[model samples]
Target chain A: MATDLMSNGNRPSAEDIAARRKVIEVDRLDFAFGARQVLFDISLDVREGEIMVVMGGSGSGKTTLLRHLVGLMPPQPGKVKLLDKDMGALNRRQLLDLKRRIGVAFQFGALFSSLTVAENVKLPLRELTDLEERTMDIMANMKLEVCNLSGFGHLMPADLSGGMMKRASIARAIVMDPKLVFLDEPSSGLDPAVSSALDDLILKLRDAMDISVVVVSHDIESAFKIADRITILDKGRILISDRVDAVRNSPNERVQNLLHRRSEQIDVDPTEYLRRLAGD
Target chain B: MANPAKFFEQIGRRTASGLDEMGYATVLFFEAIYWTLTGWRQRQPVRIAATFAAMVEIGVAALPIATLLAATIGLMLAIQSLYSLGIFGAEQYAFIGIALSVVREFSPMIMGILIAGRSGSAIAARLATMNINQEIDALQVMGINPNRFLVAPVLIALVVMMPCLAMWANIVSILAAGLYVSAELNQSFGAYLNDTLDVLKVDDVWHGLGKAGLFGIIIALVGVVNGSMVKGGAEGVGRVTTRSVVLSVTLIVVADMIFAYLTTR
Candidate 1:
């Protein structure tokens, strides 16, 4: 039963399991931005159905890795492949096709400012498919409700708060019902309760749609709660890649430091801050 | 304790890195190009409307003004020519001066100056503000090219309207010049018009229109380049806009001089 639950050790493999395709594979990737060497020989894969979390601190090149996956910032020629295409060599039309297959939720939930929520969600449909008005409206509403935003279709992004903005962006992202989704810092700015609700949404979305997900975030509790597998990156390298339970039980000092919250503390004394400003 | 020679080498490295910033600007230019191209198509109404607004602001709004302003500048050139040639008792030769200067130089230069103030700075300001608000980054993540979507259309629109503006200016000014000589200098308007047409050959008009086109290209390039290169926050966008306007206008003037020098004898 433990083995059954282990389920291929929470790693993505190109093997057939219920006839679903593997979504992402990064093979011994060595990436750099002009000698900074952001990713060092990183190797990983994400299956067609699971929430795989890339956990790291702010500047740990996780975003760089995500950009590579989306082909926003290209990696060196031969290291990464998405949806079984040689992503490095795919021409514009092919790149567009693959990109359409995937959905991305950015850190700030980068919704188009000029577009209303419904229009933003309709963008992918307009670009890729020929769905009619009723169908488009129905599909858009369903995704909106999934993100807990049912009828706020006419609201612009500027009208949304941080939490709603992420929800709306997620709605826009998955409007196409993409086979794979990439989310960056979904829980970063929200309160804990709202953040957990977002986590639940991510898990439900993944399960219901059978969509593969690669989420980049540093929120430990959120990562553990939602992630089937977590790959921890440190100093441009994957420090540990394992199932959630394995990671929790492991005695690695860095892991322990993070889990226990014993790393460093900046105690805020209102008196001290006031005194410092006032020059006691 | 590296060698004394290595100290200069270190300074050279610093200089090289500083110069890498320009290369980064070039990269931003191409990045804007790439970003503007990759986006999935959007809903027709909003796309069409935003495009319409951009065209109206960059092309239509500026067209009549550019024409009228350049025409008036040409009229002033005619006035100055009549004044200068009137002294020499060769008021008919005023066409030689006004037509050549207005068609070959002033029309394009004034048009460029007008666009720099009107559309070029506006493009820079828009891109800068968009940068502050993360629209460009949003476009990138969504696989859209901000440059191709935003700047390219404006560039095309400017290129389209600039020639129209210059032609309008040419006609208005020639008419103004003929009227000026007829009323003020006691010369027949038809004789002045025929002389003007006779002296202003086809090559001269081509040369002037060609200069106007170059001016349009330079303004678009500088404005887009500066807009894409803008970094920092909201205040930074404003700074980039200001700098872009100044640079575009100055470059237009300098380019006009180069055009004049090149096309002259």
Candidate 2:
């Protein structure tokens, strides 16, 4: 199935994105785990009011990159700038202030099990603002309504299904009306209907709230459905980042392999295989 | 055979890692202290409700077991002390032996070990599970310091509760010993209690309570540090939980020894 960026025509081109403000910018980011390198010379940008999907197969460093964008892991030997603040240079107070401007929904719900769903949604507000408890409750209810989780607030996270948990997590992420939201694997481990609903929520969030979103996902269909721009990561490097049609029509073999769900068959030498089997 | 140099290298690595972890725990301990003092200044004051919740979990919930164990220990101490003092034909001083030992050392040590195994392991497991589930990360992303929001309340609760539990144990154990001694000597329980109180100075009780407080800090710091450093997944939670209890118990004993020596000297 082929989708056309040009025919849709309302989609912004690369030049159009350049004119918009960049909410998040990563420059030459490199990350490593002890002796092993996981992210290499990675550079990407999320513009204002755009849903940027970073897609890759397992272990492709998409989650690592998301962590950097959300300021969970400081970028080493590189830079990550969010809302025009250098993440690595910020002091404690400054870092907290910066964090308040963005929100992150982890892959799993990550709701505090001790708290009810509404309490989880209101936690950031409660921690960051001295608003009256009544006001905070109303605000939490509004966000929950926005995420289509209006009455489920009284239930514990353990009581919610996978999809409801993800929605509640998103509600919490956006409750503070953060300028940017980072969602990690929102559609993962959900039925297609639920995943589609999450995708619709992402779209609604961007269009209605005017918030930029960075989603780390390997789901090709959901990525294409909601992402204004897509960055394809393979083995710690960006293979291609472009409009959805450009990504779809790209000549890159790995991108095609991912899009087509084709697994690459690695050819092995018989002698090497036998020798390795024999513990040579 | 493993190379001799590799063995030394392994030892060196382990030593360095151990020191590194201790250093981290020290830093976190100080951070918890700082947050506990200034947490009220927060835009959203760290809720007293959390502290009370922790008190319930770390302190109130363990009351029954503490009572049962301390009573049994009191009986055992009385039986042993009476037999030893019987040879001198001074069974009348049996209350003094039981009271001094119970108030000065045994009560605090037992309370510490109990809390370390029960609450300390629980703290480590809860925090590790939070870490694994990314709830800790969620808090950080929400501009809340986990040290302030999570660790400080637990630290305060434990520091407050350990002494209370220890003091309660002291009373329970002394009373149990008094009952046994009164029954043995055909003396009134009230007379036995009076003699125990007269012999046991305020300083002795304070010394035990002080050790209990120190053990509280040890348990809190060790549990928080171990929980925060958890890696991987479910197995990591189990490992940290075990490590927290073991380390807290070990450090409590070590600290008790030092405190005993210094206070006595």
True contacts kept of each: 0.34, 0.95
Tens digit per residue, CA lDDT, model 2, A243-273: 8878988998889989888766434677887
Over the true interface, candidate 1 deviates by an RMSD, in Å, of: 3.3
Q: lDDT per residue, candidate 1, A1-280, as tens digits?
A: 3443343333343334325656788988778777688888889887778788898766777988888888787668346888898688888767767877788888887777778988888766764566897889889888998989987888998899899999988888898888889998999989988987888788888878889889998787778777777898877788788877778788888776655665443345778878988998
- Cα lDDT listed for each candidate: 0.76, 0.90
- Residue B22, model 2: Cα distance from true site in angstroms: 0.6
lDDT of 1 at A270: 71
Off by over 4 Å in 1: A1-21, A128-142, A264-280, B1-53, B131-134, B145-147, B172-183, B186-199, B258-264
Instruction: Give stretches of model 2 more than 4 Å off.
Output: A1-15, A266-280, B42-44
* Ten contiguous residues with the weakest lDDT in model 1 chain B: B38-47
What clash pairs does model 2 have?
A: none
Q: Is model 1 an incorrect, acceptable, medium or high docking prediction? A: acceptable
**Highest TM-score, which number?**
2
TM-score, per-candidate, Cα-based: 0.80, 0.95
Worst 10 residues of 2 chain A by lDDT: A1-10
